[model samples]
Target: MRADARKNYDHLLAVAREVFTEQGADASLRDIARRAEVGLGTLYRHFPTREALLEALLRSSFNALAARADELQTADDSAAALMLWLRETVAFTHENRGVIAPMVSAIEDHDCALHASCVTLRAAGAALLARAQADGNARADLDGSELFDLIAALAWLREQPSHAPRSDRIFGLIADVILVRHPRPEAPNASGHTGRQPKGRS
Candidate 1:
């Protein structure tokens, strides 16, 4: 790609991320172009369709989350690492619920880049889960796709009128189910400071 074309593509992705989060999946491509300060032709040249753009957004977000897992270095406590990733995933999915809903709804009806990106994301998440399981901190039965499916389901649930609180409790439930030992639960002492403290001797 030419310098200007590369610039245009980068601009489109940045602008699209903000617009899609704010306006959901149906945010206008024309608006994206306006925000990128580029022509509609430029946006289309990089992403042929709205789904294509959404897929790119999904891929970018998933890749970012994967990088975060790497940076977390979960070898110390795979459960903690998984919990962190799960929390991030919850936040990410919550913000992108609008983008995901239509793609999920239409998946049975069409071949979509959004679906492909989701498959890839699941594979990535699965890989991380597999590693955690191998470390014996997580259950062997937890497949990556299953965990991702749960996240997607929870995200959809959160989109419902009464399911928003589920978001906070759901990930903890997931961690509880999958981890071999429940993470040291947080406790607030009489001092009013809340965190884990070393066990006192009997």
Candidate 2:
């Protein structure tokens, strides 16, 4: 694509994603073009159909998430990384509520799940889960898909205006259930303090 065409494509994508989130899968592509200050023909050129646009968007987001999982695998503390990643997943889901609803709705037909992109996402996320489990960090009982779906659900719930306060508690439950080791309760030290008590206390 030419420089201006590429710029228009990028702008249309950004606007479409935001509008879709606000107005759902039925959001008008024309309005997205308007927001992007581009022609309707330009939007159609970039994405021939609504489903094509949705698939492109989902693929883009998943690609970024897969890359982030690769980064987490490189970090020394795999458990901490997994935990942080879960929180980030929740936030992303919350922000992408409009995207999620339509994606789910599309899965009823045999034609759905046609993309191999979901497979790639699963592989990357599973690798991170495996690392965490191998490190004796995460509960072995929960497989990668289960853990991922659990977080995605939490993120879905997080999007509800009524559920904001429960977000922390929900994540807390995830930690409690998923973490294999609880920090040992502190023992009393020389000063007859519970180790949890300030070390400098008399």
- TM-score per model over all chains: 0.67, 0.71
Candidate 1 C-alpha lDDT tens digits along 30-109: 99999888889988989998888887778767678767867665457767777777778767877785755654544444
List runs of model 2 lying over 4 Å from the truth. Answer: 1-8, 24-26, 29-45, 48-51, 58-60, 102-114, 182-202
lDDT of 2 by residue, 1-202 (tens): 8998788777777888889888876788888888888888878888887767887777767788778888899999988898887777666666666555544444333355424555555567678889989999888888866775776578677777798788899888878788788577778799888856456787
CA shift of 195, model 1, Å: 27
| RMSD after CA superposition, every candidate | 7.7, 6.2
Query: Positional deviation of 79 in candidate 1, in angstroms?
Result: 1.5
Whole-model lDDT per candidate: 0.75, 0.75
Q: Which segments of candidate 1 are over 4 A away from where they belong? A: 2-15, 28-43, 102-111, 114-117, 182-202
Q: What is the lDDT of candidate 2?
A: 0.75
